[model samples]
Target: MAAADREFSPASSIALTVGSALLWGVAHLATGRRRIGLTLLGSYALLVATILSMVTLVGSDLLTLAVQPGWLTALTFMLLAIAAAWTVVIVWSYVLVRPDSSHPGRRIATIVAAVLCGLVVVPTVYAARLASVSRDVVTSLFTPSSAPIIADDPWNGRPRVNFLLVGADSAPSRPGVRTDSMTVASVDVATGATTLLGLPRNLQNVPMPPGPARQRFPSGFTGEPPYTPGLLNEVFQYAEDYPEVVPGVRKGYRGPTLLKETVGGILGIRIHHYAMVDMAGFAQIIDAMGGVRITIKDPIVYGKYREGLLPSGTRKLSGEQALWYGRSRTDSDDYVRMGRQKCLLNAVAKQADPMTVLNSFESLANATKRAISTDLPQNLLPAMVELAQKIKDTRIRSLNFVPPLISTAYPDYEFIKRKVEQTLADRPVNKTATAPGSRPQSTPQQSPERPLTLDEACA
Candidate 1:
């Protein structure tokens, strides 16, 4: 009998080959592609081993980001595409090894292979579409501007990176934007320790350092009111309205640049970057996460001057309610609201674990993108991702130059600088909340400026 005739039918070959695809190389070995089969099997085995090892190493850090709605959405789509391509490649290789078969099953076998390939291709195309849509949403969310970036100094080699976080509130009806929340985050490069330095919006008489801005103000950015006009947050619009006042203000980023410089000088630390978000957008982000469920310690009012009151206890809050919860200055002061904001943050982080992000991926991504704007470049995203791993592992210490700590009215810049230095150097008193799950103390009842554990605050 001929060799071809001696071999089993095409059905047996197709069946066995299909089985080997699971192991990714068994089918090829059974069908006389020994060299290629072994090569694939070995390569796949090595890849699997390497991936397993990497997972073990990265571990919780991977979990931290993977659950994040923004990160997971992108990852899900990418994974689907890879899976689809891989399936097609495997099937094509199997087709090449099929035994010669004039048997009736040959056509059936070809049809089956085509069907399998189609299944993968369809999902791959769908995933690609989803990923593209998401990318568009993220790109469109922020109002792009020339960052007040110092040329050739990207903090690549620094032991620390600091950035200004501004909560910019601007409405169509309003003429100018107001920065309601302003906090500077200084991150330690080596250990991922983070220090949050909060600046009150009503701060006065901030000495403007020698720059293009000094020529105009000479002494400082004197607000229109001449005294209080130069509040920390007010400087943004001041710089924007009168861009010509600051000599070297970047074409479109005058306002942000000015604020960065003023904040940097006051804090006695160089502010390398800035990130801003609309308070309304922040509410949208909360709503997108399906409303953060939390134990509201007290009945908090919203909509300016006790316009509304959110009841206490464990309940879910809509975007508007959450926004009010964070920004409500009706019954409470700015510093008190700052504490509420921290509590909201802890609630969101605790509730929106990975599975939750996946479930609400679309809404969360849209809300966050619409709300957030930052000068931090896209190129640095990978680096940030790496740093986030370390950051999650390290304890985050916070210091707010609010209340008795530093007088916002008179304001001791010297004491503020020394405090910042000591905090960055790692203060023993502030050295708590040293876990990924831990949060900076900011409960409605507890002092917002101090670091209090969630348990302590809740208790």
Candidate 2:
């Protein structure tokens, strides 16, 4: 009799199909197709091992080496091709082990099994595509569009690592790109404690790096004589205008290096990296997470500088509203605007949880494509991921170098260093959240070193 006409055990047929679903070739091996089964088993094992290694090895340099876009794209397609083959194997296996031709509805049973095989394969294909898209986004945004001017080392031995986060403004009215908002995130490598220092755009006489620029501005950067004194924000654009000052900066990434060095000189510390976001593109990021909730302190106007868009209230603002709220300076000064930016930062830090990110991944990917740019290497991602989780419980402290605390015209660099040092050292041991319904001790003292609470600052 033919194989289809031969008497077959119902249990064995069911087991073969189900077994293939679980291990791709388990049923083949169980049914004594040892050579075919072993080949499949080896392939399955290799794929599983590679995936497990990538996910488990985050926060390590090893993770970076493996997850490059090229590798991920190749792996993604390979898995999909395997899934297609597996679907074929499942259907073929059932054909080989079918019940006798005399069995009732034999054709119907075969069709049902084939349908089931397609169901499993469809989702596997979809998942592979999603992973491919995610890898593409990371590679496009962070793979370094230009050769980086600076090099990075492990912060393992250092007490702290500092990063410059600049909000780049390239308004149509402006001559060139200006760093409208500049902040430094000095983080504790071991503890994950972070200190944020906001620098106002109007800050004057900001120091230059130790180069011809510094020698020229022995009294600090004051632009050129005909132009009069310039503000801190202009430092980057100024250096770009005259690259001769900081000779040998990377061909395309001149602004980041120049700005990073200027801030480092002003604060008197080694800045490890800089990540810049275009202000116009900032709206996309906020919109990706479906806009952010903020406490609107005052009416904010834009463009014509008329017609208020956001009235004072606690409400959810779209990307445009949030950007204006952060950028508005007509009703107030740059210092107050800087305070609002800090409040916005704290709100994002507390609200943008993991679930939100996972659900809105594609939207976030689009936003990142439009708004974000960073010098951070892909290899450092896994390590940063590990560090982020470790410090999830720690409170982030804010310190702005805005007015009343220190003169912007002539900042006390020594005092600024001391505050950064103090925040890093005297940081609360149990900075984690207190138990439910239990009020923590309140501090009667407040200084730039310990900025106002988010609510107070926004108010």
Candidate 3:
């Protein structure tokens, strides 16, 4: 039979129909006499057959009705067939697991089963509708004529571009909640050089923007604004104190823009784009990918009274564990946590199967829509997917800004100004321009130790 006709194939339909009928017949037979329910069984068999056929064939047709003008219709039908087959398996499992005895519990079980079946169908149907709506919304949001600067120059002269990626623990209208975590990713598209810069939540004072200066205070200070001039760690605590005053505080931190500007100044690179992913969305995407594997370089033990344990070795982590791994910093310092973040990212990158991700695109897209906010254009999605396909896990390199590289120096205003100046000055200079302090040094023997002290590290 042709593929389209296969959806309506009588043999398959009859088998499934009969199977369902036999189950219902057995239920009725257990209640009373078998002979009395023969007619009921026959009627049920016919009803099931008709319903199955209509739902499988007609439902598939209706979904793919406006898929496209050509071969896409067939592809849509095939996808629908797959979805229906899975749904059938789920429903069949429910039918078989149900008890045959006609007790009050059985009645309740039957009602529960029916409700569950409806619940399953409802989401699938709703997801399909949501998918359709999201497709249109995405299409409208991303116009082909207009593209982002990153898309235009994926391999520009700049070796690295910093992106401040934030996960706000709370929304603006609500306060007291602070950002769960803050990450700055520096991407060098040309060489596939990527680094995940993780900032500590409790480091001490980090400067706050001018907006609601009154509300933002350091962690320890009461009545004083939370804003302090110290480490990136203290920012969240300050934001928490007077959450109402800050306009865009998520959790206690201000918006992603603040972090972006802060990191950009430190790194000496202009932030090309910013992407924000919420905790819930992060979990969904990780689960969809069947979890990720990370090789832990150091043993970590920490909890209430330091009870949690993760030995040093390769371990496959579930979404729940991964979240804890990402968020927890009590055992290790912020620098080590930054390493963990990069490790998690690398693990995800290594295990990410394109076909699997493509299949879960609907779920992924839906999850992203609710939890993520990015300045990057939506139109670049297809291109990004294609680029990801071409790049191997080994080709991607992860870096962290720590120790001697980027610091959290005090005299906050002066440090920020100097960092920004250094970044602007550290542009991709032409090889021919032999300027002092710009050219590569001669040898390791002649080079001086460039260790960044705690003061420099903070700067």
Candidate 4:
């Protein structure tokens, strides 16, 4: 056929085919395949409309759906389906508009179209993989409570929800898990304000709430034989060893259940949930986040004979360094280390921004799965994530029952309760106005009357 009689020039056909990889169906319409072209266009428009409508209607509840393993699995398959459909469209479009003659240009156009198809599939496949990983993580890490506080409300319509963060120290050399670090994170459901109450590991005479354990230790914890004089941290191993004392507790939750009751009794508040991380696994988590940045006021010494040293100054520390920063007690008492741990928590929370999380999500997820255990129901994750976003920038208030204010050997339980009540009652403070890279203004010297923010404690 004469050039004028043909539908399009070779170059024009090539352009149309390439453009179709992006515009879907345009090549078909340009090549007189009107029926197929209109169908593809209509399908694309409908998909867009449906997505927009879902977003508009669902709003924040979309996150609620995200936490469901079933939904996530479905999402992975759906993403794959979409990728397949789109790839088919790209190839079909190229077939419809490719240059008619057997020429080098036609071969080149074929190669270009293949590359474009790959570009479209690669990212979607990656997204599908992420969705699959998320499903596995949710299933393995979170156990949905058979009995939630409320059927509809994740926070159970409470003003505040308290979670006990326990850093458990369990080694082959040790008999059972030890609650090395215990902090209660009480969060205001509405405002996302939080108060962290840190309890020293060596806290003695910890009162237990009314229960079987309470019945046994009516006069507060005072270490049983083998475990030695009862310290606050010993409660975990004690509970683990004597499961009959805390009967009816979940299989793996006996220790946490008893510890929760004990801590709640001490704080005079109902502990809603508990999250425990192995002290060893904490390092992996830190590494996953690419390390935590902290302002070390003085050199920290760790290891037997003080072989490890974390020098003073503002430094970005690796997983091991952060572990030492929070755990070291050489020349420093537990009170000082408690302050350092609070600072470390604050720094990790502030520095692990969304981009960092996204970039290292796989490693972070893997480390998190191995390192942590929690009684927080899977259904509550969406709400927890929502709350975290709200409070990420809010200054964290802290109350450490250490030294001067209260002796670890004889903690004033009544005084501790009053301070906890006071801290929670106070409105959550905004992030301090301290200049970047400089020390935060010191909190009025730790008095019985005042609590410290992370900034103040760290400073």
lDDT of model 3, residue 48: 64
- Give the total clashing residue pairs for model 4: 2
lDDT by candidate, in order shown: 0.68, 0.71, 0.49, 0.80
lDDT of 4 at 387: 86
For 147-217, candidate 3 gives per-residue lDDT tens digits of 34354554455655566766655546644335545666655555444444455444333444445542343
lDDT of 4 by residue, 1-459 (tens): 532234554577668766776677788787677888889888888877887998999887787777788889988998898899889988887776677665657777778778888997999898898888888889888986666545457776799999999988776777788888999999998888888998999988777878777788887788785648788898887777788878977557788998898899889999989999887788898999999989999988876567788889998999988988888888888888888887887788788887998888889889989999998788778788788877876878888877666666656677667668867886433322332233333341243546677788787
Q: How would you order the candidates by TM-score, starting with the best? A: 4, 2, 1, 3
lDDT of 1 by residue, 184-248 (tens): 87888777877767787777667776766777677555678733456777788888888676666
Instruction: Give the candidate number with the greatest TM-score.
Output: 4
Q: Predict model 2's lDDT versus the native.
A: 0.71
State every prediction's TM-score relative to the real structure. 0.71, 0.77, 0.50, 0.89
What clash count goes with each model? 2, 2, 23, 2
Q: Candidate 4: what lDDT?
A: 0.80
Highest-lDDT candidate: 4
Residues 191-263, model 2: lDDT tens digits: 8877777888877767678878888787677876676458788887877788787788864577678788888
Off by over 4 Å in 1: 1-157, 226-229, 304-307, 350-352, 426-459
Number of the candidate with higher TM-score, 3 or 4: 4
Candidate 3: regions farther than 4 A off: 1-161, 167-181, 189-191, 195-254, 302-307, 358-366, 386-394, 403-459
